[model samples]
Target: MVGAEQTLEVEGHPCVVVDRAAMQYRVVTSDSAAVALERKGTSFARRLGRRRNTVTVRALHELSLVVERGESLGIIGRNGSGKSTLMRLISGQERPTTGAVFASSTPIMLGVNAALMPDLSGHQNVVLGCLAMGMSWEQVNAKFSSIVELCGLEDSIYLPMKSYSSGMASRLRFAIAASIDPEILLVDEALNTGDAQFGDRSMKRMDQLREQAGCVFLVSHSLDTVIKMCSRVIWLDKGHLIMDGDPTETVQTYRDFTGHLAKGNNISAVRIRDEARASLQMTEVLTRGKSRRSRP
Candidate 1:
C-alpha cells in the first residue's frame, strides 16, 4: 500500500506549491488588523434539565485591508496571536460576524477544508477537485498534464488518499489546489515540511504567479520566506495589529519585539500600553479615514 493511494510525491509533499505572487490586491486587504471580538455567553440549566448556551467571539471592529494587485503581504505573529484566525477570515471560509470581506474575486484557501476528497482516490480526486473549482472539463483535462508533471506523482496519483503518507498526501493536495488559476490564493504554513530545492521551486512558482496570475497570501513561520519572498509585511500581537510597513523594516521590528518579549522585560507591558494607544488612534483614524500611522 506504499503507493496504493495516489499522491503527488514531490509537489504532493509540498502542498500549496504554486506560491504565486499577488498581482492586484495580492495583499489588498487593509494592513490594519483591527477587530472587535466579544465573548459573551451564558450557559445555565433550567428546571426541566434544559440548558441554554450563548454565543461569543464577537469582535465586530473591522480593519478593511485591500491587498493591492501584485503585492505580497506577510502575516507575522506569535502562535495564537490570531494569525491563523485572520488567515481563515481572509480566506472567506468563515464570516466576520459583524464586518464584511469583499475580495475583487473569489479567494482559494489551500489549508481550508477544500483541498481533499475523503472517499475518492488521489488521482481521481485531483480531476474532480479541479473541475469543482470552476474549471471546465476540457480545462481540467488540458491542465492535468502540467499538474501531474509539476506534482511528479504520475504513478501514485491513482490510489486512495487515506493510505498515502502524510508528506505524499500533502503534496497531492497542493497540486490539486493549484490546478485552478486562482485569483486570490490563501496558504497557511502548508510548506514547512519540504526540502530546500522544493522551497526554491515553489518560490519560483510564486514569482510566476505574481507575474502571470494575481495575488496570494502566505501564512508561514519562515521569516526568510517572508523576507525573501514578500514585498511587504504585517505584524500582529495578541489579536491587535503591531505594525504594517516594509518587510525589511517590519520584520526587523517584529524580531526585535519578539526578542524583547522573550527576554521577559517590560516589553509585554509596553506592548499592552501600546495596544491601548493604538486602539485610540484606530478610533481617531478609522472614524475619519485619515490615519497618521500611529505608533507606540
Candidate 2:
C-alpha cells in the first residue's frame, strides 16, 4: 500500500512552492564510539558485551524546512548544532531515523572532507570528481581549464592531492562541485578555507548557481559570511531550529544569545532562548493551521 504524504510548514511565511520542499529529520541518535567498535568486532578487550555502555547522541531534531529555486539559504549554528548533519541528510548520505526529506533533484555537497585520492594529482582528481558528479568525459575535458582557473590552483593542479594544503584541496573540491551546475548545492565550510580572492570567485559562482534557478544551502560558522551570501538564514541551537527568516535579524538574535552566554549571564541567555522558542512555537501553530485549512 502507498503511504501518506508527509508535509512540513515553516513558520508563517508565504507558502513557497518549493523546487525542494518539506524536509524533516526526526530525533536520531547513535551509539558511542566504544559501542560502535564492539559492534564492528574491532576489539573484545573490555568484554562488556551486551552490557556495554551505549550512550546515544542526537545530531538533529525535528528540522522542517523548504528550499526554493533561486534561493541561497544559509544554515548557521554553533559547532555540533547539526548543520553538517542536516546537509548530509539532504544529500542522501544519511537516512533519518524518522520523517523524510524530499528534493526535486540530487544535491551536490562540498565539504572540507570531500573525497579526493591522496595519491592522485589534483588534475586527475578533478577528472575523477567530475565523472563522479555525472559529467560526461567530454564535459570534464571541456571544463578542466575553467575549473583550474576558478580554483586558482594552476601550478598545484599538477601535484598530488597529498602535496596540497587543506585550503588548496578545498578550493579544488569546490571548483569541481560547482562546475557540474547541480540543481541543489550544499556547501559545508568550504568557502571559509579559501583565501580572499578565492572567496570572491566562489561567492560569484554561488550567485551564478542561484541565477540558474538552482538552490544553494551553505553551512558556516562565520555569521558574516552567512549574512553576506544568503538572502535567508536558519538558526539552529542544540539541533533545534530557533529561527528561519531574514538573515540580519536571525544573526543578531543568535549573536545576542551567544554574547550573553559567553559573559556568564545565564539568566539573560535563558530569557533570550525562551523568547525565541515561544516565537517559533507560535509560528508553528499558525503554519500548521494554515496547512490544515488548505488541505481537502
Candidate 3:
C-alpha cells in the first residue's frame, strides 16, 4: 500500500520530508505462452494457479531525505535507479509501498510524458494544462502568450500535439508547468529535449522559482546541468540512495562509478558503490514528538 500526508508546511517553511519511503510492485512471472493462453480464455482457476509465482520487485528501498525551502535539489542515477519513483511519490502521483511523503504543497511535475491531449492542438493543451494546475481562466489567458513564446513553438502552437515532435511536446509541457510558478516543482528529464536557447530560458525560470522561496527537485542524466543548477545533489543506485551532498562531489563520484562500469570494471564499480553506501548518513524522521533515524 502507498500513502501520502499533506503537511501544514508552507512555501517559506523549513523543509519537505520524505520519511522512510519505499515502493515495490508484485510481478507475476508467467511465461509468454501462459499469458497468451490466459488471453485466449483459460480457466480462472488455472490462471490463478499460474499467478502464484509472483515476485516482488523493489523500486525504492527505505529512502529518507529532506529538502529545504528555496533550494534546488538534483537527483542523478542510472536508468531504473528509483529517481522517477521518488519524484512520483513526492508529487503524490503515486504512493510509497511503505512509509510516507510529507510536503508543504502539492508538487507540480513537469515530465517528458506529462498528461496532455495528443488529439488537441498545442494551444488547447496549454489552456487545459494551466487549468489543471489550478490556474483560473483569466490567469491562463494572461500567461498563454508567454507560455507559447517560451516554448518557441510559434505557428506550430496551432498544430495538433500528436503532430509535434517529442522535443516540441516536451518544450510545451515545460512551458505550461513553469507558467504556474508552483510552490513545489518536480522536473524529470524535460529539459533534455530543448536546444541551448530554450535551456537558457528554462534555467532562468527555475532560478526565478527558487528566488521566490520555492523548492525544486530535478531528476536529470546531465551531470553538468545538475551541477550548474542545483545547490545539492543525491545519487541513487539499484533502489538505494548512495550519496547526498554538494553537487560537485556527488556528481564526480557518480561519474567515476559509471566510468568504471563503462570500461567493464565491475569490481572497481562495486567497490566505489559499497564505499559510498557505507559512509552515507541516515536521516531522522520525527513523529508524535518522538524521533527515529531511517536508513536509505
Best-performing candidate as measured by lDDT? 3
Error of 2 at 22 (Å): 13
Compose the digit string of candidate 3's lDDT tens values, residues 1-296. Answer: 01122222223354468887899987786666544644566576766676365556789998677788878899999999999999999999899998888988778787656699999999999999888878999999999999998899999999999999988988998898788777788888877778899988887877776666478899999899999889999999989888888999999999999999999999999999888766663221133123223322
lDDT of each: 0.59, 0.75, 0.81
- What is the TM-score of candidate 3? 0.82
Q: lDDT ranking from best to worst?
A: 3, 2, 1
Model 3 RMSD in angstroms:
6.5
Model 2, stretches more than 4 Å misplaced? 1-51, 290-296
lDDT of 1 by residue, 1-296 (tens): 00111121221221122111111111122223321111123233332352222223322223435466666778888886667766767676565544445566767776524557656787788788887888988988898876676556678777787877776676666666666666676778755644565556555656665455466677888888888777777776655556666888777767767776778866674775476436545654553432224322
What TM-score do all the candidates reach, one by one? Answer: 0.70, 0.81, 0.82
- The candidates, ranked best first by TM-score, are 3, 2, 1
Q: Write the per-residue lDDT of candidate 2 for residues 1-296, one digit (tens) a residue.
A: 00112244443222122222223432323556645654575456654554635534567765566776667889988888888888878888877766667777777786556599999999999999889878999999999999999999998899999999888888888888788777777888877768999989988887777566477888988899899889899877777777778999989998999999999998998798779767877776776677789977
Candidate with the larger TM-score of 1 and 2: 2
In terms of lDDT, the poorest run of 10 residues in model 2 is 13-22
Model 3, stretches more than 4 Å misplaced? 1-13, 30-52, 281-296
| Comparing 2 and 3 on lDDT, the stronger one | 3
Every model's Cα RMSD, please? 13.2, 6.6, 6.5
Where is model 1 poorest over a 10-residue stretch in terms of lDDT?
1-10
